[model samples]
Target chain A: MMETIGIWVAAFLTLSMFSFLYKDNPFYKFAEHLFVGASMGYFIPYTFFNVFIPYAYNPLFLRHNYWLIIPFVIGLGYWFRFSNNLGWLSRYPIAFSMGIVGMGVPMSIHAQILVQMRTMMLPLTNINLILIFIGTVSILLYFFFSKAHEGLYGKFTSVGIWFMMVGFGASFGYTVMARLSLLIGRLQFLLGDWLGLIK
Target chain B: MNFSDYIQKIDRRYIFIILAIAVILPLLFPLGLPTFTTPPVLSLYKHIDEAAGTDDRAVFMDFAQSPSTLPELYPMDLAILRHCFLRDIKVLTISYYPQGAAIMQMAISEVKEDFPDVKQDVDYCNFGFRNFALRVPITLGMGDNIAEAVETNAAGRRLENLPIMEKLKNYDNIQVCMEISGAAPGIIYINYARARYGVDVAIGVTAVSAADNYPYLQTGQLVGLLGGLKGAAEYEELVETFANNDIPYSEKKAQNLSWRNQQYELSKVPYKFKQARIGMDAQAVAHVLIIIFIIIGNIGYFIEKRQDKNKYVK
Candidate 1:
């Protein structure tokens, strides 16, 4: 009986969301607010119990990890943003985070940039490899703002534009598929899971 | 306005209705449109098939997907879990997002319903959700001691007490770490886990982020990828095929059949399990509708242009 009631509530919300296709209405707004409120309601407790208690409280108190106290103090600095007198103190935590991220940037570059460049440097023995090399070079050339895109360079940049367009088109097509999949999920829930209209 | 203008300026509500019909009709009566596996997905399947069961090598699943992405990502999660259970592959599951813990739990429960004899904490364990800020340290720590890195399961039970962690100590026992997320954590895993510990990484990402991971796949950072609903559908096909060949229908598939497909033949998969494929049907129909509309709109546009040109000439 609880499951049935849950299904009805879900079906109502699903239709409420779908109602936007006609025009904006109170149902859609209610569903939107409910979703946000429900998410927050779920998030706060889960974070407190699962994240804060385990990662913070357990380590500081149970483990007697005195070193953690430093980071704990730094984390507390974030709360200072609420104090008009000490609002500037929040920058310490922000700066600390930025510094840590700065140290991590090189690692990201190593994986995302350096490694990618190395892969692109492979011997172009095959036609597919040759095309890839060409596409890569031309696309890079297209973004070289200092150089004038004219004559032969212009043709290369134009080819790069085509490559970009093709990439965008593929991405767009997949985006459509993704959106439709979400709709299909909702429809399945309403029709099959809720109404038993589908086998 | 002429027919062309009318077609050009057709009410969007009409299109919405058509799309609704396209989606609904397929659900009611599945067309069973065929799905093909891509190279990235096949690469992932092949890696798991070859490396999973040997030397205590387990698959570490990072459940980073949010609820909004469940429709697209959940099927892939379910399919992977089903595959792991069927192959007797030791699995360790974790979630980064808070909501992901619930989704992972649901997937585990649904998949567990099939393998009754399979023991939890021994065969599979869920590490649950962690703070995003701790992602790097936790991943790096897993390189040394998984039990130490992840102290407890989602339920606050000690990880060392879990039977699966007895043999599985760290990255050495982990064959491939599959990170499924709407927002791809491929880079994070690649930078920390793979670069630091040599752990093989795979990604199951939403289609929007799928293209971004291609460079990683090409560079050998990611072993395999399942992108979006299509990827999920493809993976499902792989699982179904693998099950049909290896496990007899009566022994494995029959018992695990979803409630919706109880009346169907042993060969026929349940609708609940076949979500990705069923979704693909709606996808195909919707694509066709979009294409038809695009053509009609373009035709109207060209006609309008030609008529305007004639008026200027006159």
Candidate 2:
């Protein structure tokens, strides 16, 4: 009986979301608000139990790691943003996080940029490698704002544009597939799981 | 409006209705469209098959997607989990997003239900969500000692005591750290875990992010990738084929092997395991619809342009 009720609730929400395809309606709004409220409700306790208690409270109190209190205090400073008089205090947490991120940027550049460039610099012996190398160089040239694109440079940038268009087209096609997959999921739920219309 | 204009400006509701019918009909009656396994997906399967066998080497599965992407990502998650379980590969599952904990639980339960004797905390364990901010530290810490890095499993039980943790102590035991996410954590895993500890990494990302992963794959940073629903379907096909042809399940207990043996006999793939494959039927039809609409719209546009040119000539 509970399973049946759950199915009905899910089916209702699924149809409510689908109703937006026609136009804006109260059903869609209700479902949207419900989703947000439910997500927040789920997120709060999950964070407290899973993250805060395990990483923060347990370390500070149970383990007696007093140094952990420094970051905890900085975390608490974020609450001060709600107060006009104490709003400046929030900058401590912001600055602390920004500093940590600043430290991480160099490492990230090494991994994402330098490593990627090293990979691209490999011997372009194959057609696939040659195309990849050419595409990367031409695309970089296309975005070269300092120099005006003309003659040979213009032709190179034009090739860059073609490569970019092909990339964009592939990405767009994948996006459509992703969206349709989501729809198929909901429909499968409504039909097979809920209505028993499909096997 | 002219005929060309009318054709170009067809009501979106009509298209929606047609698409709904197109998708729904396929679900009701599956077309059984053939799925071709791509090289990236095949590479992932081959790596897992070869690498993760002994207790010393295991698979670290990062379930980083939420409920919103369940349709696209869940099937791939299930396929990978099923593959691991069938091959007797020890798995340590973790969730990066809060909602991922529930998703991980669901996938495990579904797969575990098939193999009743597959013990939890031994065959598999789930160390639930951690703060994304501490991803670097947590990842690095795992290289030193997993039990110390993640103190507890999802159930709040100590990880040190778990039998699975004995062999799964560090990155050396991790054969492949596969991140099954809509937003792939490839860079983080590559930067910290792979670069620091020499761990092999793979990703099962949503199609939207699939194209972006090609560069990483090209650079040999990622072992393999499963992109979107198509990727999921391909992985599922691989699993089904592997189970049927490979793997000596006959030596094992007959009862433990019954579920898999029954599920993959001849050409009768079970619907539960074929979620992504069945969804592909809808995908194929929808792609056709989109292509037809694009062609008609383009033709209508050209016709309208020619008519306007004729008007100017007049």
Candidate 3:
């Protein structure tokens, strides 16, 4: 009985959201505002209690560890938003985060980005690999600047563009598939799990 | 008004309405379609299996998805949690989004029914959400006391008093850290946790972010990758293959109870990833529809371009 009630509430909220499709009406507005208020109300406290206090403070004072306060102060610097004179205090933490993240960006790029590019460039030694290699080189040459449209380079480059277009088209197709899958998941819940219309 | 101008000015509501029907109709009547698993997702499952075989292994689940992408992430999260719990692996879930915490709690409870004997703090814990994604790990890693950061587990208990992790020093004891996350927190895990610590990382991310993680996978940094529901469904299939063949408890327990006994019994629960499989089917139909739309759009473009060319030629 409780599960049924909860399901109905979820279904109603979902419908309220969908009401925006017809027009930007009151129902959609109300739902959107309610969601915003509720989310912010929940998030601020959650972050403080779960992550801030125990992970930050407990080890610092309880364990007699002064070093822990470094992050604590860095985190507290974010509250400088409330201060006019000391508002610049927040930048220190932001700068620290950026610096650390900056360092990581190159590492990740080297390991993840460069390696992936190399893999796509090389390809496995197979029939598909041979085809991909030929296509890639031709595509590269298509942009070659020494001749006019009366030559093979111009035509080959056009072919390369077509290949790139098809690849991009496939990627877009996959994205559509993923989004559709999500929509199906929610609808399935409404019907199969909630309404028991479909087993 | 001109015909071309009128067609171009079709109401925006019409697009939304079409999208609604397109989404709704598929749900009411599913078209079962085949799905093929990619190599990265397969590797992820194998890595998870290998990790679980080790001692006191823990997987940190970050549930940070929102309503817009709910359909995709929920199924995948449930599958990974169930797989971890069934093996008596320590599972710790932290939510970066407030609403996501509730969702994670609800999913964990539902999945826990399959493993009745699993304790709250001992085998599983919910650290809930704390602000500042970078701060949580930085503080925890610094102090060697993560429980001190959060006041209570998801069930609302004093973290210091929790029976679980009373013996552990820090996250060093954890063998793996798997994140079923959305965009922002996924980057957090990669940047802070994976880079700083030597923790084996696996990611179950939304489909949009899947390609982004491919670079990480190619580098052999991420052991496993679950991209949206399809990846979840694949993992389910892989786990289920082994879940069923485990030794039965009744006849075997009469002889002696071993460490594997707890896990064998947990595996008795059904191993179907119903949601992800269903979502995959819907996805197949949606892709076909979108492809049709794209072709139509291109045809319209070509027709306009050709007409312009003819006018100039004359």
Please give, for residues A1-199, the per-residue lDDT of candidate 1 as tens digits.
9989999989999999888888999999999999998877767777787787787888899989999999888888888998999988888877865655763687787877788888888998899778777888899999999989999999988899888888888888888878888888889888889989877
Give candidate 2 misplaced runs (Cα > 4 Å): B244-267
Q: What is the DockQ of candidate 3?
A: 0.37
Q: How many angstroms is the interface RMSD of candidate 2?
A: 1.3
Candidate 3: residue B226 Cα off by (Å): 1.9
CA displacement after TM-score superposition, residue A43 of candidate 1 (Å): 1.9
What value does the lDDT take at residue B112 in candidate 2? 93
What C-alpha root-mean-square deviation, in Å, does candidate 3 show against the real structure? 7.1
Question: Which scores better on DockQ, 2 or 3?
Answer: 2
Model 2 chain A is weakest, by summed lDDT over 10 consecutive residues, at A96-105
Give me the candidate number with maximum TM-score: 2
Question: For model 3, what is the alpha-carbon lDDT of residue B272?
Answer: 38
| Clashes (candidate 2) | 0
DockQ (CA atoms), all models: 0.70, 0.71, 0.37
Error of 3 at A32 (Å): 1.2
Residues B25-80 of candidate 1 have per-residue lDDT tens digits of 98888886667667898788877766545547889999998889999999999999
Candidate number with the higher lDDT (1 or 2): 2
In order, candidate lDDTs are: 0.83, 0.85, 0.65
TM-score of chain A of 3: 0.78
Interface RMSD of each: 1.3, 1.3, 3.6
